[model samples]
Target chain A: MARVVVDVMLKPEILDPQGQAVQRALPRLGFEGIADVRQGKRFELEVEGPVDDAALARIHEMAETFLANTVIEDFEVKVETSEGPK
Target chain B: MTARPSPTATLNGGPTGRWNVRIGVVTFPGTLDDRDTQRAVRIAGAEAVPLWHRDKDLKQVDAVVLPGGFSYGDYLRAGAISRFSPLMETIIDQAKAGMPVLGICNGFQVLTESHLLPGAMLRNNHLHFICRDQKLRVESTSTAWTADYTAGQEISIPLKNIDGRYVADERTLDLLEAEGRVAFRYLDGNPNGSLRDIAGITNEAGNVVGLMPHPEHAVEPLVGTGRTDGLGFFTSILKKLVNA
Candidate 1:
């Protein structure tokens, strides 16, 4: 089995209004315990067989084309394992 | 009656330059939608020129588009570093002189960073990366980039982003509304907690426009969403060129 991890976030310069809103509401919610809140998404994929460079690139392409919007987000892909040929 | 030199000829020396309008689409280090923006311009029957973020010149393109994508990996801010690019200086000057300019998604963030338009984009209310087919009402049609759309015309476009909220001082928001400068408004639910549900806006002269939605992605019917509601933006500029 092969495992892949994807981390998605807004491009650094893109304003993260959602994060700001949450920050603003944190105090109002009587949860002043939070210092800051920046939000993003994470995905984990398990694929079959040994993960090769080509397969990794395909996964990246998929992330770019659909999984993430290159406009506001960037993604990092991590391969956890690639077992021997099935 | 005397005839004026073709706009294309005055801009770029291309063959059949008589009627074709040439537009430049700028690509920053991390730009993601430059290719799609160029394709949209081409499909609209205009020549699309690719411009680099580091380049100081616009290459004499009649109009310009700053496509979406992270620039400089959003290191300092989403568009903060990119706002200092040499191309932005030229674009700012040209846009001030009435050249048409459009900014989409990350491009919109860059514009806000540059202070070309008054406001800033912030994180969404939900604190999540929101992606969906968004409905927007064209709030104003006077802008050179939006002439083909009618005011109040609701159209659908693809929206994908994390930092997509629009914000400004209350007074500034009031002025934008009073002056009818708001270019587009979000319909249905607010995607990113944008103030007053604003999806887009234009400058006073109606030459520069900025919006958080990805219109380029909606220009093609064969692509993911298969909605072409965003093609009007490209066609509108072409019509403006033809009339000019």
Candidate 2:
């Protein structure tokens, strides 16, 4: 069995208004020196038994096609088992 | 070309007689605008067919309208999950085969998610849900929708959505422009920070269009902001069906 996580984030070139609103408010709360902030989503999936190379590839495909809108977002999959999130 | 007649002019009778077209309005669980869309279709002199998101068949409607609303609670991004609904599978195939499909607001997000249209929608540049009577210029009259208005004619409709800013790669934007796929664009002011001031666009075949505004809300003088700028979209589809 393997547990994996996928992080989906808007591409750097894309504008993130939510992150910007938060970034602007931080200064009012006495927090400074923060250059920027970006918002994203993280999805954790549990796979039952026998993780293999093909399984990893399939997970990557699922992240690209379903878990993320690749046109404007990028996704990274991390295998939390043998690999410490490569 | 001049714009169509006044809204009251069509109030006398939906059409001079019965129209042969049936327009389908899909209702996803969270859809808030299905009734409005059906009303618009009826006002346009067509039979308004009610379609369920869970239903796989399209009911042989001449056209389909995916109305605005928070489908699937706008979870995992607006329109993402709804794009995979059972009905959407049929819609995707039918839309690709040149069936007329108009997606408004959240519906627009679904069209993009399903790859029936290019580009994606992001949060409004101000990171808020913006609701307003937005002014838009008709950039193309060749699509399944928008044929009732002349190119460059400006109209106002209710624009409401949280994730409504349109984004696409430069190449795609340029291609859309070159191909005249930009069916509608913001006029007066760019309300949502959309690229190129685009408010709506069409597929390559022009049978599918996706926009961030609710044209359904503007089809009548008695409801919504009392402006009738959106009647053209509904009427335009009927015109196409008649001509086909």
Task: Identify the runs in model 1 with alpha carbons over 4 angstroms from their true place.
Answer: A1-86, B1-14
Cα-based lDDT at residue B198, candidate 1: 94
lDDT of 1 at B88: 90
Model 1 chain B weakest lDDT span, ten residues long: B1-10
Question: Model 2: runs farther than 4 Å from truth?
Answer: A82-86, B1-17
lDDT digits (tens) for residues B33-71 of candidate 2 = 999899999898888999999998877777899999999
**Comparing chain B with the reference, what is the TM-score for each candidate?**
0.93, 0.92
**At residue A57, what lDDT does model 2 achieve?**
92
Q: How many backbone clashes does candidate 1 have?
A: 17
Each prediction's number of clashing residue pairs: 17, 0
Docking class of 2: high
